[model samples]
Every structure is written in C-alpha cells, then in structure tokens.
Target chain A: MAGTDHDKPLITGGPAIILVEPQLGENIGMVARAMANFGLSELRLINPRDGWPSEKARAAASKADHVIDGAVVFDTLEEAVADLNFIYATTARERDGFKPVRGPEEASRRLRTRNDAGERTGILFGRERFGLSNEEVAMADEIVTFPVNPAFASLNIAQAVLLMSYEWMKSGFGAEQTPFAGPDVMPASKEHLNGMIGHLESALDARGYFRPAAKKPKMLDNLRAVLTRPAFTLEEIKLLRGIISSLDYFSPKTPRGSGNPERKAKVDRDRHGKSGETVKDEER
Target chain B: MAGTDHDKPLITGGPAIILVEPQLGENIGMVARAMANFGLSELRLINPRDGWPSEKARAAASKADHVIDGAVVFDTLEEAVADLNFIYATTARERDGFKPVRGPEEASRRLRTRNDAGERTGILFGRERFGLSNEEVAMADEIVTFPVNPAFASLNIAQAVLLMSYEWMKSGFGAEQTPFAGPDVMPASKEHLNGMIGHLESALDARGYFRPAAKKPKMLDNLRAVLTRPAFTLEEIKLLRGIISSLDYFSPKTPRGSGNPERKAKVDRDRHGKSGETVKDEER
Candidate 1:
C-alpha cells in the first residue's frame, strides 16, 4: 500500500473502484491492498469469477480487510455502475467507436473535482482475459487507457487498479503531504557525522586499509560518500562508532602493536608520512 | 503494466530495484511486473528466500520476462547496492537513527536528475516479514517509506516497489505528456451527434416514452448528456442510429400500426410539434 491509514484523510468522496469479472483471488486481494494504499475504501465487484469471500483474497490483501469487507458485489456492469453519476472504463485496446479517453492522472483530477462537487464517481476495470465488452464500455461516460507499450499493452487486473489508485492518492495529497518518515527520530548533526567518519577512517588506517597513498583521497571520498549517504542519526553514529571500535580492537594489528620496535618500524613505513599517526580519541 | 513494450525510450538509465531476502517467488515476479510497468529493467536480488530462477516468479511476472531474465542476485545487501551511486532503502518502521526520508515522488525526481547526470542509482526493498535491518539500511543513501496506514503499515513487497516505480515513470514523463488515446479516432461532429440524438428521440417519441409532456425537456437533456458524455466517434453515432432504427422498426406500435388508434393519436399529438413523422432509411 502507498500510504498509512492515519495519514490524514486526504481523499473526500473518492471514486469507487469496480472490477468487472475479475478472475484471480490474488488479483482481488492485491486490488484491495492497492485501494487501501491510496485511501480508497469502496470495492465493487461485478460477478467475480472466483466468487466472493475468498480466503486467498483475504490473505493476499494482507491488511486491507476494510476494503474487502465493505466490497459490494453486483451481477452486471449496469448494476455495478447504476448509482455512480460518472464512470470511467479502463481499457488497453481502442474500442470500435470514438470515446474521449483519459490517462490516469487526468482522470484522477477529474474524479477529485467531480467527487468534490458532490457527484458520485467510479472507475470500471475489465476482466483479466478479455477486458470490457463494447456494450459494457458503452455505459461508461469516458474511457481511461494507460499509455502503455503498444506491443504489450496487457496490464494485469491489480496493476491497472494500482496505477489508478496511486494517481487518485497523489491527486488528493499532492505528494508533498505524503511523509517520508515520522518525526520520531532526528537527523544527526554534521559534526557528529564528521566525528563518526573520523573514527572509521582511523580504524581503517590502523589496518593499512588506505594503501597506495596516491589514490587515498578518492578512496576516502568514496568512503565518506558511503558513510554520509544514509544521514545517520546520533544513535546510529554511536552504534557505527562502536562497530569501528570493535573492528579496531579485533584487528590482527592495532596502533598499540607499534609499542614493539619491529612492528613500529613496519607501521612507520606503511604510514609513509601521510595521515598515518593522526588518531583522535573522541567520545560522543 | 502501465506501459506497453513499444512506448519509445521514455526512460534512460533508470534505477535498479533491489529486493533483500524476499520470501516468495510471487513477490519477485510482481516486482518485475511493476518494474516493467514503469519502464525499469535492472533487477537485483539479495539472497531470496525461495532461491533464484523461480518458476512461480516467472509465472507471476506475466509479460515482464525481460526483467526476470536479466535479474542479478547478490549474496548481501552490500554487494547488491555497491555499484550504484545512490541507493534508497524502503522500510516501514522507524529505524534506530534519523535519516533523510523521502516519498517516492521526490526520490524519483532525484533519481532522474542523478541518472541524467550519468550517475547510477537503485532502490532497496526489505523482506516480507521484517524489513531491512539497521545495518542493511545503514548502507543506503536515504530511506524511503510509503505513507501507509499506521495501524497496519504493511505493504506487500510488490506494492511498495510499484509505488516507487510509478513515481519514477511519472517524474520522467509529466502527467500531461501521457496520452489519453491514440489519434486514429476523432470525436463525432456536433451535426452527427445531433442526428443520432434526433434519431433516438424520434424513436422514443414514437414509442410514447415522453408521454408526460412537462418532463420531456429534462428527459431530453438527460438523454443528450448521456449521449455526449462518451464523445462518441462517427462510427459509434452510426451504430447508435442503427440501434434506434431497429427499435423503431421492431416496436409493436410503430406509426405504421397503432394498437389503440386513440392512444396513438394522442401520442401523435404529443410528438406533433417536434420531429413529427420523418425517418431516414440508410445502409452502411
């Protein structure tokens, strides 16, 4: 699912999703999940091939039981869309006659507008194998077709539903309102990040990890890039620093090994007058 | 899938999708299908639970055989995302530390900008049961989490990937750029529409459908609304006109034979001022 349940009710009067003769239970469950991801609750099935109340669908739906529980089953497309003031039929192939077609994004906006204006709206999806018949499509006010690969325009039932549901959610929330993560954790300051990087650098240096000092700068930059990329928190930095400390202590050769003459001479050669002996013992 | 195979090269250097410890082949296949929907090709797997080259995954992928065929498997998350310049880990729960969390939309834009600048990028999704570990997420440049329900923040692996892939495709091609339909069919002209409406209206009038004269205008308006809503093609208009003609000819009380002459005369009186008694016979 795209969004959490409590992420502010972004959608108001969102369109109902009607699946016509959907075959597989997995697809139905996935459709329910996709709907819930986008804050869509209404699920209308027009004579689902596998029948209603399927265990496979429930299991596949994962946690979107709300959508499946409230799902309305209809005998025909006409019955399915009887209450909707506006309807959009999804189809991959162009039908026999001219119908105004809309892509998912545009259709989503229209749904929002019409829904906001107090008109009931719903999107109709066809069967998995054959799609909506011409007569079934005739009942729809607009045709919605994905700008898909012409060579392979077949979209499974759930994928089509997912695209539409995603667009609907995006239209309601405008992407900005969708949070990346909750504010329970705060980002570690730059100084803390720098300190952790220094800790790792020294640990690696002690192990002769930065050999061939000529290419050390680029290697250091790469390491820094990798370390700083995740934007570690204070706690993560502390954990990483602990890991660095463990590595330094567990290594076959430590800086303290230089207390012996022969090892100290080898360490001096490895250091090579670069950043060899700059180990800062700082605690965070 | 959102797009067909020949939707032109709309995306260049799209990001790789890495799944870590995926449990089911069905999930991997769905991820491939979702990726193919948005024109993504590169797929990297990190120690899948069901193993590689899964027959179930291939079956689930449907037409995304290309993505499945090219999937790369890695033993660890470190190796999977190593070659990529940037990586975002998808996780539902708040991990140990703070990281820059981005929604799919923003992340997708960054990915496009980086890819356009010749930087390789990829996204990491954790396992089904438990998401990426702290150590695994620590390797990512950023964290990406769906704005899912707090009570049940579980989005199946494929749905998460689908949202990200959809955002990626949408960022590359603005919603406006997505076509509604191909340009082969044109909306029927007003004259053709009017002709079809008139045909249906006269057929209904002959059947005494508008017997309540006061409501005729509203009924006619509603009829026109239904007719025009679909933006019918010329051929559709012709087909509809044919249907009207068939109904008129097959009506039990066609103008040619009045079941009750008095009632028929009254119907004639109601339809008197309007399209009185004209019918055109044509063959396509």
Candidate 2:
C-alpha cells in the first residue's frame, strides 16, 4: 500500500505539469509522486537545476517510476510548452494585473474542459525560491494562485504540485466519490421499527418509567422522536428488540445469564416473520 | 516571504489537526507549515516518534513558528481529541463498512459547519508509513478519505495535511476570489465598434475585397461577425481603427513610412468626432 502496484492500470493523461527551472531533484521526485497520485503523467521540465536523469528525484518519487522516467526536459520554457494550446502560470506573489487570475479549482476546471476538447493544456511552476518570472507569467494565457493566508503564501514546489494535481483530479473525476464507498445498508421498515418501539414502551410501562399519567403522552412522543431519528437498519432494529426483550424478562433469579430461552426463541421467530417476505408484502 | 511574519495576525481556531504517532519530525514541520498557509493553527500530536521539540521539525516548518511552537502533544489519540465534539479519521485504505466515509471536500464542509456552530472538531491523521490502525479509525465519528488513484492511494502525511488544510480554507473563504484581481478594462462601446467595422468595410470595398457582387451582403455579415466576437476594449477598438486607417491610405511611395500625413490628420479629426461627447449624444 505504501508503494506502486504495477499490476493495476496506471491512470495517465491530463494537463502537462511544467516546471520552469526547478532547483532540487528531490522536489522533482515529490512532484512526480503527487502527479502520479492524481493521474497526471505528463511531466515537462524547463532547464532543471543539476541537469536531468536525476537519481535524487527517482528516489524521492517513491516508486512513481513512470512519471520520473517519462519526464521530458527542455532548454527553455517556451520550447517546453511549444505544443500546448493553453497554459497557466502558478504564483504566490501578486503581479501587475495583466492576465486573468483564477483560484486553483476554477483553473483546474478550465484545464479539464480544454483537455476534454482535445486541446493540450499545461500549468507552469517556477523556480524553487523565486516563482515564475514576470516574463514567464506573461507567457501563460492565465494565472492561477492558491487561496492561502496572504501573509504566508509561500508553498514549496511539491506542495504546490499536490494542490493543482488534487484539484485537477477532483475536477475531472468529481469530488463526490472517494477511493472507496461507505456502508450500503438499507433503512429498516417502519413496521419493524414500530414493533421494536412498542416492545420497549411496554417494558418501560411495566417499570413505570414514563412518570405521572398526565405526562405519559408527551414522554412517549419524545421517545418516538428519538427512536425514529436514527433510521436504523433491519439488523439494528432486531438488536434493539432483543435488548428490550432481555430487559423485560431477564432477572438475577434466572438460571443463567442467557436469559429466558423460551422468550429468546419467540423473539427469533418474530424477527424472521418481520423480515424479507413480510416487508415485501407491506410494500405491495 | 519564505518564512513566517510574526507581526501579522496568526489565524487560529479551526478544527484541531490530530496526528497519531507520526514518525518523522520533518513531516510534522511540513504539516505545520501547510496548516499555517491555510489559516489552521491548532496542532495536536499523539505520541510523535523521536519525541517532541525536535530541531528537524522546526527547520522543516520554514518559520511557521507559531504552529510549531503552540503544538500540543498527547499520550493517546483519544486524549488528543477528548474535547472535540466531532472527529474525522483520514485513511487511504478501505475499511470494513462501518462508519460513514466522506471525500475531503464534503468532510471539510462538515467540519466547517460544525466549527461554525460552536462545536469543537478535529481531523485525525495517522502514522507516516503504517497509517491509522482500525482501532484508531473506530475511535472517530466518521471516516474521511482523499479521492486519489486507487492504484496509488498513498499520500505522505504532509500531503494529506495540505489537502485538508486547503479544503478547509476554500470552504470558509470560497474559491471565487484569487489572491488578486485581473485587469479591469471596460468593453468597447457598441457605437465605437460599429464605427470601426464600417471604416474597415469601406476600405475593403475600395480594394474590391468582396468579389462577385451577389456575395457582398454575406461577406459584409461575415466580416462584422468576426470583428464583433471579441468584445474588445475601447483602446483596442481605437488601435483597430488606426490600423485600418493606415492600411487604407499608406503606400510604398509615402515618405518616411508615415502614411499619407494629410489623410492621417483627417483620420485623427474623425476619431475625435467619434469620442465621449458624440457617444453620449447618440445615447440620448
């Protein structure tokens, strides 16, 4: 789970991640990892520091070998993005208003839309210390900035890559579905729920737990409200009924902690009668 | 710009960030920096490896001293989140259908809503390599997972922290506004656009650019459509008119490539006549 699974299909193809003069090979590796996590496979580097074929980056990639291995290098930023139809330059610093600046989410949507239309789009990241130059920003069609605390907006290269990659993935695949789904249990039928509630009420009535007769109706209403709110599953309703049955019949005088076996058997028979067939008949 | 600004107000009091037995001090530092970037200040660490007060973490925090300095440590994850009314456990691996699982965006919204309602909430991040155990996840009210590639779902501790922090910031501040606004030039007046189109049409007419007399109207419509699509600015319209004027009157025989000076003077005079006063009068 901590490393790559070569057997599973590697999701590829999205906007190119263009790094303009990225300083550290380790940063490049982390960027590759982030890109891999979000299914962005295209990596373009414009004059990376210490040249290409970086072992440091490969090690940092943490087994995202495909991205690091497929990374393309260029002598200039223009050459790197020459074939791209649209480009976005990422920056933390404010510039003299020229290109339209978009937050990451909007920019990701635009990039995804353009990409869907068969247009090649890329986002440019700057040098490790000083972000994209003014000339570099001008080269892009638009600017994208992270919505961060303006006072401490400096995000490391990999962190920036993670945000854009995350947003790009969310834009294309949507933000609704996670890697896995939640539990898929259905709500319990009202008949089963009312049966459980009635059983509990009867037990409470025997114990005189509803207080004075004048307030019994209000207390029942409150009890019903609480029980109805959870929308419990069929299994949960059965469990509740079992608990009520145990409380109503079991005592220290019982032969064992197993409670009255006859009552338990009756409870099991009643639960079966209330399930599947009965529920379907009720629906009909 | 790379470091913290102590003089600036530190944004605090969002959901608490609870890290369970995090292995690396550098990762903790990075998490702190990511939190600071997105205005999340409260940090709760549950038994970090290598103990607390590590110099490596401080250096990695990149001067996000406020977050690192104010970080609280707990002996257990339960104790770390003892006061929180709501909790979300982050996991990369799928679990055995129990708690409700939400994607980061939805989870962020829920966290923000609970926080706004004056209820304390926290997000639980697990160890660097092993992640949170099932027992640890079972301690939370809900499961929150990233929408990452199923084949490569592993996200470093810092990256996980960054995504949660980013979504939290976006949930509160919104994604509509970037750090700065774009250029604010007004759209060109329709009268000005019409005037420029008419001048260009006249020039083309003089050159017999619309061949075949029967197609003249269609050709004129096509010309107007292309010119009208951009919604050009006032300055852009003026530049377009100037270009057209130069094309209509200039010749290789003209001295100093200045275009016919007499015609240029007339063009200037006509442009003045089509200015603010003329536009306002026409509107009336």
Candidate 3:
C-alpha cells in the first residue's frame, strides 16, 4: 500500500534500474549505494560480473546493501525493461535511433513525473565494460547521458546512476528552488514555444529556408525538433528573437543565402576597438 | 590577402569556428570568448544576433574580445569555409546522414593532423536558436558533438565553440599526454592496448559473456571504447580491470531474474565506499 501512487515517494517512487551485463561486483555494489543515495531502491541486474549476493559487493555497499539485496538480475535488457511503461537507456556513446535523448537531470525529471503517475518506469544501465548497445537504446523511449568534462568523460558506473538520481530527486521532489539563482523563474510552456516557432518560421520563410513547397512541412518539423527540444522561457526566447530581428534589420543576408558579403567577412573585431590582441592581423 | 592563413598568427592554430544563424549577440560574443580562452581566435559568423560589430556582443565577450573583433561574417557556411579543406559540423540533435561522427576530441585530432599537413581546417557550430540545418550538417565531412548532459544538451554557442576549441588545443599541443606523469613517462602505446584487450577479452570469455553468440562483437567493442576513450595508461587500466575482475569472481548477477528473493540483504560500510550524502529525504 505504501508503494501506491499517492503514497509513493517523489523521486524514487517510480523507476527501477536495469543494469545489463555488469562486469564487476564492486561496481554493482557501488551502483546500489548510488541508487540508494538517490532514493531509488528497485534495481534489476542482468548478467552481473560477479554472481549476486557477492561478498565483494557486500563489502563495498557501505549502507546500500538493502538496494543490492532488493536488486533483480536478468539476462538481457529487453526482458529487464519489458515490465516498464517508460524505459530509458543510459549510454556513454551515441547510438543509432530516433529516441529523444536527454541528460541525467532531464531524464530524472521525466522519470519522477512517471513515478507520480504510478507508471512503472525503469532506466537501463549497460555493462561496466561497455554500455547499452544500439539495439538496447532503441528499446527505450529515451536516452540519458551526462554532461561531463570532454577531456575526461569516462564516468564510473556508480557515478552515472548517482548523478542521474540526484537530478531526478532534486527536480521532482518539489525542489525547484535552487541554491544558485538562474536567469529566470519559469520553464517555457508549450504555447510560448509555439509562438517562438511561428516567428522563426516566418523568418526562415522570408529567407527561403522553406525552399521547395513540398519540403516546407518536413523542414518545419525538423526545425521545431531541434530548436524547441527544451523550450526556452518567454524572456529568453523574446530576447533571442529580438537579437535575431535586430541583426536582420542591420546586416541581413540575401533571399537564398545570408545577407551581405562585406559585412559577413568582418571578424566583428570592434569589441575591444583597435587595442584587442592583434586586430590588424584578423583583418585579412 | 586577408584570407591567407598567415594573416592571423592564430593563438594556438587549431580550427576556426564558423557559427551559422546564431541568434544571440551575447552568445556569439560568448563563443568568441570561449575560443579566445582556449587559444582559438578565428571566429566566423554566417549570420548573427544584434548585427555585426555589435557593442553588446563585445561587452559580453568577457576576455574574448580579440576573438570577437577578428570574427568574420559569411553569407553561407560554404563561403565561410572556402579557405578550409576539411570541415566538421556540430549539432545537438542527430542529423539524418551517413557521415562519420566523432566526439569533439577526435574531431580536433583529425584537424590537428590536417593542420600539421598545412591543410586549412575549420569546425562549424550551428546557431543556438535553430542549430545547423540537416542540409548544413550534410555538407560537412564529420559531425562534432560533446558528451553533454542529456537533459540540458543545449550549449550556449560560445560554450560549444569553447569545448571544441579546448579539445583541439589540448590535442594539438599534446597536453602532458595520457597517464600524464609530471616528470615520469607518458602513457603506453597501441600495442599495449591490444595486449590488455586480449587479456581482458579472454578473462571475460571465461566468464560466459560471449553468450547469445550475436552479442559478442558489440560487447567487445563497447568494452574497448569505454576503456580506451580516456586512453588510460597501463597502470590505470590495469587497476580498473583488475578491480572489476576481482569483483566478478566474488558475486555475479543471479542466473535467473530473481535469485532467492527471500534472501536477507548484506551490509558493508567500507571507508573506501564513498556514500557521501543520503539521497532519500532531501525533499527540497
């Protein structure tokens, strides 16, 4: 009864973690700890490196043995995720698919809501050695990745699950208030983005991006998907469009291409006047 | 005369940044700033926010004024890229194309080789407002992307430029080298990787990972990529894989989905196990 919709906890309430082909008992243990840290207790392991009830994992779990004991092990991602209504695949590499990929925070946010809805949701984490395969990613409705230092993007197994869980919990547990102040308050609503899209379409059409008549609709959808993925709130959108309109008025491109050539070739070097580093060097 | 490579004594001489239809002057300025910080100065704007030579952009460029002022505007990416022999396009969304895609570091690595050959190369970043159109991405040889937070995949134009520039500079300069020891030796070689991979693969084979027959190749590739991406030195990789193997032998995933569900969860609170914060009750 406690696991029922309204009675369930916010962040950990919905999704289960399905680790496919994990190779290390320690990583399993660490992952369990991370999961517990993020409030998620339901775990499913498919082909773990060490067998379950691992002493090594038990030794490493810290306070998360509860999560480990509760974790389920399976043989494949498909069977692991079959029980869930919404499935998210976690990966470190780009996969071939049409799935909407989001970072950990976004994934958590979406998953948190599903929990509130009482939907059985799960996140599939691939093996510690590799990650989820393309086929595996295709099975999920979404893909979750993390923004890490590009110079060093090899996040540990436990780190990945932990970071995602952190964000999901923070975003979904009525923790919208932040420690650091962001630019604005509200997330861009769908209607607000639609207005922005209309403006952008007009601008594109004027520039002939709609080119052939038959391609217009498809182009619009593509443009919309790319531009409006995470909608920008009204202020941000308005400010951006304002900047675009101003630039168009001043240095607009041609009908088929962007505006003037002379203006385009200039390195906008006027920022620091003639004093910036070597201004003349930039002036070809 | 200006288009000549000699015209600009490029800070670190990596790749030029060409931004198309970037909607925010602040963002363009920021991109310039991002480039400048990483010793990248060539900034090309196809179309920008707030007009060329925008004072607002200059002011916002922070320390990137040198990059902002030297920025070149282009009517199209083609015109902007005319001087470069190789090109890479950056997009947040997946482009429907067959072009080989590379992460930012790899993109820079290729460009560094071309640069060493004295071949002019440039990296193109799409507008923050709409990103590069699929057509634009198609015109390029490779797609450059960041391993970013999936939920907040959008990088400010400058942020994206900075990320690529950082990778390009890091590689071109060969920063320290992987397993970078201050006064000690650099990392191991490709030969070392082969041996290590062979060893690990054999170890994994012994564990029954080659199961299902169809999954072997993908699993191997996935493991190889994860281990090699950060290019771990002999010690690092050895330490990592060693830990993994040790854990595997201890406890593996339960053979079936649920292995004795009634079993009591074990507890281990090792100090090495970093269970820093509790994720459960932070409802705020």
Top lDDT prediction, candidate number:
2
lDDT of 2 by residue, B192-272 (tens): 665666565544443344556676665454444334433355656654454344334322223222344354354344434
Docking quality tier of candidate 3? incorrect
Native contacts present in each candidate (fraction) = 0.21, 0.36, 0.00
How accurately is candidate 2 docked according to DockQ? Answer: 0.13
Cα lDDT, model 2, residue A245: 37
Query: Which should have the higher TM-score, number 1 or number 2?
Result: 2
**Per-residue CA lDDT of candidate 1, range B137-195, in tens?**
99988888766534445577887887888778778775544444634556778877876
Ranking by TM-score: 2, 1, 3
RMSD of each: 33.2, 32.9, 31.9
TM-score-superior candidate, 1 or 3: 1
Clashing pairs in 2: none
Alpha carbon deviation, residue B257, candidate 1 (Å): 19
Instruction: List each candidate's DockQ score.
Output: 0.08, 0.13, 0.01
In angstroms, give how far residue B76 of model 1 lies from its true place.
2.4
Cα lDDT of model 2 overall?
0.72
lDDT value, residue A62 of candidate 2: 87
